[model samples]
Target chain A: MKLNRTNLEQRLDHLYDVIVVGGGAGGLSAGIYLQRFRLSSLIIDKGKARSSWMQSLHNYLGLPPDTSGRKLLQQGKKHYDSLAGDFLDGYVEEVTDAENIFEIQVKVGRQNSRNVKFYSKYLIVASGIIDHLLPLEDMQNVYDYAGYNLHVCMVCDGYEMTDKLCGFFAGSEASIEEMVFNLSWFTPKITIFTHGLFEVSGQMRSQLQEYGYRLVETPIQKFLGENHQMTGVELVNGSVIELETGLISMGARYHNTYLQELSLEMKGGNLVTDKLGRTSHPRIFAIGDLKVGLNQVVVAAGDGALAATQIWREIRKDIGPRKWLMNLKLPT
Target chain B: MKLNRTNLEQRLDHLYDVIVVGGGAGGLSAGIYLQRFRLSSLIIDKGKARSSWMQSLHNYLGLPPDTSGRKLLQQGKKHYDSLAGDFLDGYVEEVTDAENIFEIQVKVGRQNSRNVKFYSKYLIVASGIIDHLLPLEDMQNVYDYAGYNLHVCMVCDGYEMTDKLCGFFAGSEASIEEMVFNLSWFTPKITIFTHGLFEVSGQMRSQLQEYGYRLVETPIQKFLGENHQMTGVELVNGSVIELETGLISMGARYHNTYLQELSLEMKGGNLVTDKLGRTSHPRIFAIGDLKVGLNQVVVAAGDGALAATQIWREIRKDIGPRKWLMNLKLPT
Candidate 1:
């Protein structure tokens, strides 16, 4: 069934209608929808989606509890490739928009010698969020149990955390409150350790007292563990608190450098999109974790579909006889 | 290895904080979040989702093409049930809100005589949409090819229409123009017809002319088919438009009647929900296909998670000391 295929270099002159930057759940889903809508698309991925760091995901529907993050990404890439979607393993360095056409500058490869410019009519930024790692010297040994015992999302791993003595490793900001309140859902034996000064309102302090949460303002000198599993934490006060599992509720720092370049509005760290996935920048759209809201795989996929459908609707209007846009008439 | 544990039902009594009224992707995802948020929740569903009408879904990312809608649903349910999530198989006859509580009346079983009532502090409407079926005097033949060759959701099945002549069965006033325009995405060889006067717009008429789409105003006297797959349409005008595949773009009627008893705000036949899945009434939340925005599984799941998180935030505020939400006079 193998037919002789022509080289892609011969077809280099064909410009894509849209180029999706990032190939995580959001980007891949958007690509699937665009291709179905009959629009040519390409995905540029540095291959570091948050799901890649996941050891195992229990809440990802339709997947087995033993499903590994590595396996999930591999399967997703295969599915995208099956559609004949194009991809270049590289990093998008900068983007500039002028006259509704986006000029993307990408730096690819190890030596970083290769530089290429791509022009697209529309852009969808699915660049996912980046996790702030704990500054423990032995952080690698601590992260090995991420998919199994230690976890980030309570919705994804709370069932496993139920009835277990859990420790929330938070810094001196909103992470302290987020951990103290959310960890209450899984177990009552919860302790919030602030590596610095604990900030709280008067009412919040009273609530903490009522909830009976043991709060320690002391910092952690060392993370004691055995075979990649955390056992206890040595405090700066020359004391230790034994624990089975702990979540580093520091903060999710998104690589939103590209977003700063655009004159787009932001709400809750995600691109402010309407019912359709349209940003303030009319020609550009954003979906998935990059755009914000619940950072789930399924939600990201839906964002992709919604964005693709909106783009398709626009294409239809442009391709049709109605060349009048914003009172400007086109030669039809 | 399974143990018949102690009965937790006696303690549960009418204590469910939230009751999600469907077990589709939206309901299950909501259940997962609600449970993780420490809300005593139950999901009652008949287990029939919109995707149930799909044979193969090509746009739902991260899965192989050979995956069936049934497999997706089965796996989704398995994921929910594994988390000790409760779902009753029944049809929700009525949903009435009283003060801050919700009462759901249901009819269960094949006998169709048993009635039951369930109560919850809050409600999340993940009850997805239902597709409306047309009266084809040939009922037996029409039902057989439902999820196979006959399709809905062009975003899900449009890729299969490539290089194939598609016959769109509009049959209704609402679907006439939409069907003609949407089907234009896949093939140029598209024929659209209405059973009666399909008020054609000036712009639409020109698109039809430019695209060379055959439009027939005559009603179909009979459906031409064998082995449950349609081959052609026999028009009352004694005309026959042969087609290999058919798209029933007729229309989908949303189930919003249950919300009518309560005077909730509605916009364009959808419940008006805020960013946190809150309806006009704070006690009530809407998720999945029943609410506003794109009717997608992923979006529904996102709605469910948001609703659960909103409810969780409220519960945490409730559990703390000194009635933080009761307008207590704060000391200056």
Candidate 2:
């Protein structure tokens, strides 16, 4: 059933086999597999996944190299829906475990929305992370080319910035120190832009000098770009710095806050999962950016499959197969 | 370069960064990631992958539930080729390690094929397993519906046979004992066909009797089917046991003979790998069916990405990034 405010009340009456948070690659993948396994599942998506903002996915296999992450997510949702998996656009607020059932409290939509509660035997948290972008009065100026020439995720876009005048936008000295080492792989001509966000350590400044790299400490007014291709940044001091490409070094906001009350084992900001994506909590499975593994779309999709299959194995073993159920006469 | 026999000799002269020994979902995924990482790679495929024979892939994310594995592999190959990754249709015969380079000997084509040797800094063994089918004189008659109705993987196709007349074709007594317990999940009406391959133990016979299941120890003449949907099996005794769907539990042939000389590490028939798909040997990575993990297309594709990213990180650290290379004057 496609879940909305009107039908959400009716659907909540019956407990789902699994409640998957976040309808991104991982959640959608899990939904499709669970439905194929004949398990009832519902996917509650907060909003756009971090991958959806990606301009192009150059590494995912079987896809056109230029395929955007948004297109993949759209297709994944369609695939999950085709299998009769339930889906809803809602932000999960809290989850509490009681008597082997997970009570999930969700708020549908962003503002002045109705709250709903759902119950599931198993819980899969695939709520992906949200990248932290530059804080500005008009953040849209930065986002205009955020996923284009102005990028995040050095691992995904470092190759695209080869040999160009690269700008590193850092929120802290530590971010600048680490990003410079990573960006050097693609280009030697790099300039670190502190954007007057934080003070750079003396040791970090010396290291940058030793590497023949430049550091700019001026606060930026707005990003200068055209046609969704970032060219440079204009500082508030009335001086403009030209750049061929840019990388944001600020970290991400992991959307696992709702899970904090459950007190599940966590490593850093991610939930540590076993090889099969099962968290320390037996009935809770974590995948994608929420788990301690490589944050790639393909990896997340694969994680979803493993978790779904493992859950099915556990359920199958417990119920001793569906043989007895076949013999039961139904009220049809 | 696309490696045909003509250019195979010339291409072998240059050592590839990584030589992937399979062109299935796993190998092609790794090839795409490697090329995107700006690393030279070559994929050597023996021919048709096990996935290529799959009638439908119901669990893979973002794809239609009815998408065939052959279609996925075809798209994966095209994606890899677009990134300029080299591909060859050949069977790897041997892999020898000497002086930090893997010398791979391959036999091209099946009939009086030309033997060729290639060198690589790293090796990814994605050569997946091949399933063993019933050895009937007219096995193609069985294969006509093998992937469609005569399924091999119970985990993948058990739901498809729900409440239907299922036939469990087991090669050995042990296989029958376990497969019967698993097949019972989908349907209670299951008949075990030994095909005169093994004698059923007394304990096993009693267990089948207790479950109200039928056991046929007859030598099968052929499987009767039409339009790629299995109908029944005809025995040499001239009796036909009707079945709506069938599950084959004859096991599989792991394709890692070329790495026998290495003797790196093994868990049963599979090579044990770390979270990043690294085997005991530092330069030798294993993914897909060769690795000890779930043998699914999505899992294999994820394994490929993990293996490729780890390989790239190692190479990047060793070479001190691509910055210096950017400054080098070209021959032109």
Candidate 3:
């Protein structure tokens, strides 16, 4: 059943076998596997996953290269719902472990939101990192081509920018020093745009100069584009520079604040997980961008399945056979 | 291009960025990623992947619960072909590491087959394991329902056999003891069928007797069923034993014969791999059942992606950019 505030309260009477903290590819995959294992699961989604804004998924296997991330999520949601897995369009405020269960505090609706608590025997954190886009007054201007030609991941879209006039927009000199070297693999005609956010050091400036990459320190007034395809950028002092594509290397905003209280084992900004996607906390699993692994949609989906299988193995060993299978229907 | 014996010689002239062995889910997934990454690759398939016999992928995420493994493989092949990935239906004979590249010897056909040699900068061993089925004169009878109700994976189909009169067809007493105890979680009414393969130890017999399970020692048999649904078994002496389902506890044949000369690290039957699916040899990667991980379709697909990305990273660092992307097409 689709979970809403109305039915959520009543459903909380019984503890769920697993509570997935995101509705993105990873969480949905986990929910699908858990439900197939005859274990009850709930997936709470706040909406707009990192990949949702992606213009296309070029490397996902079995999918058309131009298939949009939004379409993939839509299809995944349909698959999850067909299994009768419970899904909610709400934000998870916090998850606190008590005794052997996790008490999740969730908030439903944006306006005059009501808080609800649900219990689960295990938790899967699939909440991924949010990319920091160009900080412009009209953020919609950035969104116009953010996921289009203006890409964030060089590992994903670098090949698409081969031999093109590429612009590198970074927030710091360190970002410029690092990203320019990486982007050099795609195109040598790179122009680093600091947008006057930070001062470029001599050492980094010489490194960029040695690489024959142009550096622009002008404060950008606005991005000039047509039909969601960015054409160029106009400086605050009235100079416009034309470019074929752009790479945004500002930084990332990891959505792991709710998990801060647990103080789980962390590597940089990600939670360290074993091969099976299990975290330091035995009952808590970290998958997708939340875990220290490749942040690909297919990898995230696989992580979910591994986590669900591990959880099933644990529960099965504890309860033994016949207990869970009695509740499942035989496949025809 | 679809690789057949006709174009195999001309293709061998070019050094493939990656040569993937076995055209199962893992190999195909790696092929898709390698082609998308702008790396030239070839997938050599011997045909009839183990999963090809799976009646239905009941637990695979995003697919319909009743989708057959053959159908999934067909779709994956179509997806790979659409990307212009080369696929050859042939068996690999041997792989010998040269100075920097690996030379692979392949046998193209069964009757009047010719030997072909191909060079690859990297190798991915995705040749999965083959299961041992009942060796009977009417083995075709077992094949009719091998992957249907006559399940091999308990974790995958245990729930489907819940509360049913399941039969355990094991080759060894040790296998019988282990599998029956594990299958007990699904149904307690399990009968062991020895088929006169080996002598059952007294200790193991007592253990089965204490579990309130039946034991049957038979010599000759043919499976009885209609439309691939197994109903019962016919013994050599014309005795019919009825059963709702059956579990084949035979062993598996790992397909890593080509790499036996490499002296690569091994843990029991599986090759140990790092998080990115890289084997002990930096240039070689093991995925699917050949690697030490969960043997599921989704996991194999994910492993292929991970291995391809890692290869890309290594190549990217070694040669930097433009060298490879120049061989790639820009996303339109």
Candidate 4:
């Protein structure tokens, strides 16, 4: 790649109408809308959207039922490409706020690198979260049916496990205590398996007893399943418990690394914003799993659209209604 | 009609998690995502979703690149129904915000009948805009090829008009002043066809000259086309300006009337929600077209998912994370 001069000072993209960081489904979706609104914007993604690794996506509408998460990310990126929306497959280092602009510093490469500074009028943080997956012996095997058989959000997949024997594996007591309760949404036949670690409270034990759920604290030998579906689990104590589904309630690591400096109100590890996708700072916005809400690919994509549109409206307001309206229609 | 007292609350056909106020693409998409999140929501429609009446959709991704807008809407509703989301063929009279609940009064039947209130905790105003259609001798013939040939959003359909002779039809000189300039995205070959309206000012005339666009202001109009493709417009001056495509920029009135009572930040004809789909009103939320920005079915669906998940996070926080986690299995 050639070290090129910046793309002109007055060329709009230099002083972007909108800047969307972390190009997951949410970021790309925002990019598509901004393009449609005829706004000069850019999406800077390090090619590390959390949704990229999801094995299966069961509930994204408009897509074929039971599609893969990786495929959805690809399609979202393709959609953004179609609009000719400017995007960089680079990581955003930091963002410094100003009157109505953001000074963004980006490191362009891993080996032979470059420094790029972008000035943006508005910012949308569509960066999704990082799932906390266990380092099991066969991780690739476990992820093959990750979204289908093994999942995170029970609300997104619990109803499908009706009347089926399910397993709740936990790394901590709080997770164990929580799993014992969340599984009651669909089925009653649940078995909580802890890897030789038990920190259950006396009150929790009585509650678990009242619910008639069996507890297995033995270390797991391996996951027993046919093909990719989890059928059961074998324990080190030489016990084989049959199961039809499994939920691993470990935890989540939201990719809010850049947001550490920018103080924003967060509830349950998510940035809080008003309904228009605006963050506490007017120019700064957040979407997808990074915010305090649902963690679905479709949801992130929608947040992308909302934040982008909000940015569009604000940007137009600056250009004045007459200029904004005159430039609203695409010439042909 | 019998009112079942014992199971009275459960014996309702219009009970919903969030009663969306429109039945267009946005409402349909929102309904689908809400159901996917397993929220019992209903879409109250006035049958005027601009996209629903269109014959095709070109900008929406994932379809065959040339899907009909009506077919897309049908598929959207079908997707929602598949997931068990409800719909009502009613017109909403008013929406009252009560603490954390919304009492939406809707007109279901003919005169001399009792109106019903759809009580929902959350409200997604996917209720889209009502496009002002020109009432000519044959109004039906004009809207036949709306999504296919005669479009609304320039971003959604501009690229399709590449290298094609397109016309921008406006009702007033003010509209002509605003729309003609914004249509610069599709192609440079454009002409402003004013259907006998106000005279253009010198400033407006200069802008048109600077952009090298031709302008026409005349009366009478027969929208002529063959095989559902607009061929041209026959002017009242007995002149026919041959063209391949056109978009009627009369105007869009986003009916967020249901949201008027909620004391939220309203901007540019939309309810401003934060990055996580939270409105200024703590208990209220808004998404889709009513929330502003790029109005599309996929975008609305995404909004629906975000709103639900945001609520889920708040619900999880209020009810505690253990509420979702409380029902799962206990360690054995």
Candidate 5:
């Protein structure tokens, strides 16, 4: 059920078997497995999945190379609904660990919204990260080509930029040192644009010169492109460098603030998870980009399955056979 | 390209970046990712994946619930082919580790066939397992209803047997002790059928009686049903016990004989790997049912992506920029 104001009031008192924090590919896949395993799940989505911004997914197995990320999520949502999993479009403000169950505080609407609290025995944090784009004056110009020719992930879109006149936009010197060399595997013609964010070290400058890579430290006036295809960039010095493709290697902001009070174990910006996506808290699981793993749609989907299956096994073992046989209903 | 007798001879001397051992979901997925990363891969399949016997896949997210496993494999093959990954219908006989590269021996075709050798820098063992069905007089009778109303995996088809009169066929007393209690989560009306294979202890018999479960030790004469739907079994004593569903808890045969020469790490029958599906050997990987993980198609697909990405990173680091930039071409 798509929980709205009318339906959300009644479900607030019910304790779900598992409450998923986001409805991206990972959350939806988790919900589907949980529901099929005869566990009650409520997926609370903030409606800002990073996959929603993907124009085309080329590496997901079995899917056509041109299939968009949104299309996959839509189909997943429909499949979850068919299995009778509850889904709500709400932003989770806070999660309080209440001994046995977690109290999740959610804000329902964008305007004149009411805050509500729901409870769940287990929680899955699938809230993914958001990538930071180039800090241009007109952010709309960056958005126009962000998911297109201006790609954010090299692992996903490197094939699309193979052997093209590519522009590497970096926010920090570390980003260039880590990724710029890897990007050369796809294309040799790379021009590094620092956007005046950080100074390049003398050692790094010599290495860049050795590789015949041009470095630009000037701030960008605007992205010069039409029809979601980035062509070049106009710098503050009024110089233009034509390019066929662009990569935004600026860092990203991880979205995991709701569980700040829990003080879960963290590795840098990501949560430290076991192979089953379990966090330090026994009942809480962190999957997808929020956990320490590769940020791919297929990998996240697999994480959801592993986490949900482990949770189900725990619940089934704890409840025992007689109680489960009497209490649970066939999901017909 | 689909390698055949004619084309296989020409590409015999060519070395691939990766050689996958199965054409199931995991091997195909790995091949897809490797090809997308501009690494050459060839998937040599033995033609019998456990998933190919799955009649309907209900839990794969983003797919219709009624979609068969064979349909997913067909689509995955098409997707892999679009990226120019080589696929062949041949059984790998042996794998010899030659330090940096591995030499694979394959037997092409069943009758009047020729043996061939292929070489690869990395190897992925996705050659999955085959479940052992009931050894009836006529095996066709078992195959007629194996993938339909009768089931093999409790994790995959437990929900499908909900609230029905279930018949649990166990090969050993251990299989009954482990799975029979879990089956009660879906239905309490379970009858344990030993088929005169193993003796039931008094403790187990009392436990079954306490739960109101029937224990039938008599060997069956034949199964009763029509049109691929099993209804009951006819015992040798001319007695019939009706059933709505059946679960075969027999074990499976793992297809990893070709890798016995490598002597990789093993946990029971599965390959013990790190989170990235890397075995004890650095250049070899194991995914899907061959690795110690959940036996879901989506999970295997995710494992493929992780293994392929890690391999790509290793290759990119070792090859360096100048060589990769000059050697690798755009996949178009």
Candidate 6:
């Protein structure tokens, strides 16, 4: 059931078994399982899933190597909708843990929006993080090649950049550690670009010299690329360095502001979760990039199934088996 | 590379980065990841994956509700082949763990089989379990509806049995506990059939009577059904008990016999694995039903990705980054 502002008002009184906070692979998978388990779930999505930006997902199992992450999410969303799961294209503003149920305040639209409250017995926080891109003066230069040739995750796109003239764009000194790992696994022709964000230590400079990797501390003027394929970069000093591919090791901002009121267990910017994706609060589960696990689509989808199954077990135990038939309809 | 008896001898000299013991969802997924990471892997399978018997998988994300498990395996196998992962249709007999690499002995054919040896740096034991069906005069009768109207896992098929005249077949007295859980989640109109295997206690009988459930302590003659849909069961005492659906709560035989040589930690029938599916032995891993986790296809697939990533990280750290270009070919 796709809920809009018109139909959302009538469904407000109904308490869902679980409320999923994103419509990415994880949230959609959880909703499909919950509906199959004979439980109601409402997915409130802000439509900013990081996977939507992925042009191609080469590693997801049972999918083609050329399949895009957006296509996978579209199929998952259709599967959830087929199971009659409630879906709303609204942003969750805040979540307050009431005694028995959690109260969710959602902003319905981007402009001329109205606040609405929803209730659910359990909550699944699948709102994933957004990666911080290179802070170039013209940000459009970065977007042209961000998902195509300029990759973010090394584990995902390292093979794509094998043996190429690669550019390792670092956000901080600590990100240089990941560059070393990438150099070992992918290509050795990597030039570390600081983008003038932070100063390189003396010891780090010596290590770079020992490895024979060039260090560029100048700020970038713009990326010189055509048709989403990054070819080279021009520095502020009007010097051009030709490259084949690039990796952005910049940090990301975790999208968990709605859960600020609930002081759940945290590990840095991620939520610490059990094997079943349960947080410090028993009723709340954090999965996908928000939790301390690999930010892969398949891993997040699996986390969703485990969390939904645990919630179903808890709910089934609380409410004992049905004793009477009572005009029961056959499960479709 | 699909290895048969002919090509199997030629590839015996090469050492793979990982050797997966089963070609199920877990092993296939692991093989796919290992190949994408530029690590060689070979999946030696016995071709008796438990998921092959699953008629349809309703919970796997992004797949249609009616997608058969065999279809999923086919797609996964194709994906793995596209990445040029080695695959063999053989049963692993034993694994001898040496200090550096593990030596594996395999039987290629079932009847006129030939012994073969393979070596790998890491091992993933994905040989899943096989459910024990009811022992009857005619075993084909049980197979007719085992994966159809009759089900095995309560978590997977409880919704399918909702509001139906369900026949709960128990293999042991402990299986009755699972029946109670099923009743709470599914249908209350359940009849417990002990198959004259064990004696029912007085307290248990009293509890069944109090809850208005029938206790049938009779040996079943045969199942009555048509077109793979079970209708009823005829007892040996010339009595017929009608049923709309059935659930077999019998136990399963874990297929981890090949790992018996290694003294790896085990919790009952499953291997004690870390969150990354790593066993007590650092080089060995366990996934799917062989490990202590949810027995779901998506969960097993996710476990494979995590285990393969960990192995890639270890190998990358051990072998430092390449120092020279050396006519490197682009990764396909």
lDDT of 1 by residue, A1-332 (tens): 00112233342455678888888878888887787677888788877887777777665655665677667677767777777777767678888887878888776665734667777889988888876655656666556655456666665666677766777767654675665666666666666777764665667556665666666677777777776677777887889998787776767777567556776898767788776678888878888777757777667777888888889888877885222122233448
Comparing 1 and 4 on lDDT, the stronger one: 1
- Tell me the TM-score of each prediction against the true structure: 0.86, 0.95, 0.92, 0.74, 0.96, 0.95
Task: State which candidate, 3 or 4, has the greater lDDT.
Answer: 3
Candidate 2 lDDT tens digits, A187-230: 87888888788888899877776666778988889999899988
Top candidate, metric TM-score: 5
DockQ of each: 0.32, 0.49, 0.32, 0.21, 0.46, 0.46
Candidate 6, residue B257: Cα displacement in angstroms equals 0.9
Q: Write the per-residue lDDT of candidate 5 for residues B1-332, one digit (tens) a residue.
A: 99988889878999999999999989988988898889999999988788888888888876778888998899899999998899999989999988798999999999988899999999999998988888889888888889898999888898899888989999998998899988888888898899898899999987887677788999987788999999998898999999999999888899999998988999989999999999999999999998998999889999999999999999988999842344234456
lDDT of 4 by residue, B48-158 (tens): 576766565544544444567677677666677777666776678888887667788876645554566778877766676767655567787777656667777665666
TM-score of chain A of each: 0.85, 0.96, 0.95, 0.85, 0.96, 0.96
Compare the candidates by lDDT and give the number of the best one. Answer: 5
Stretches off by above 4 angstroms in model 3 are: A323-332, B321-332
lDDT of 1 by residue, B190-221 (tens): 77766654666677667666566666767776
Give Cα distance to truth, residue A274, candidate 1, Å: 2.7
Residue A232, candidate 3: C-alpha displacement in angstroms: 3.2
Error of 5 at B244 (Å): 1.7
DockQ of 5: 0.46
Off by over 4 Å in 1: A1-14, A194-212, A215-228, A234-240, A267-269, A321-332, B1-13, B110-112, B196-210, B217-229, B234-240, B321-332
Per-residue lDDT value at A173 in model 6: 93
| lDDT of each residue in A22-99, candidate 4, tens digit only | 777778777777876777778888876776665655556566555666776676667777767777766778888877
The iRMS of the candidates, in order, is: 8.4, 3.3, 5.6, 6.7, 4.0, 3.3
Ranking by lDDT: 5, 6, 2, 3, 1, 4
Docking class of 1: acceptable
Instruction: Summarize candidate 6's per-residue lDDT along B81-134 as a digit string, tens digits.
Output: 988999999989999988889999999998899999999999999998988988
Candidate 2, residues B217-322, lDDT tens digits: the string is 9899999878998899899999998999999999889999999999979998899999999999999999998899888899899999999989988888888633
**Backbone clash numbers for all candidates listed:** 1, 0, 3, 48, 0, 1
DockQ of candidate 3 compared with the true complex: 0.32
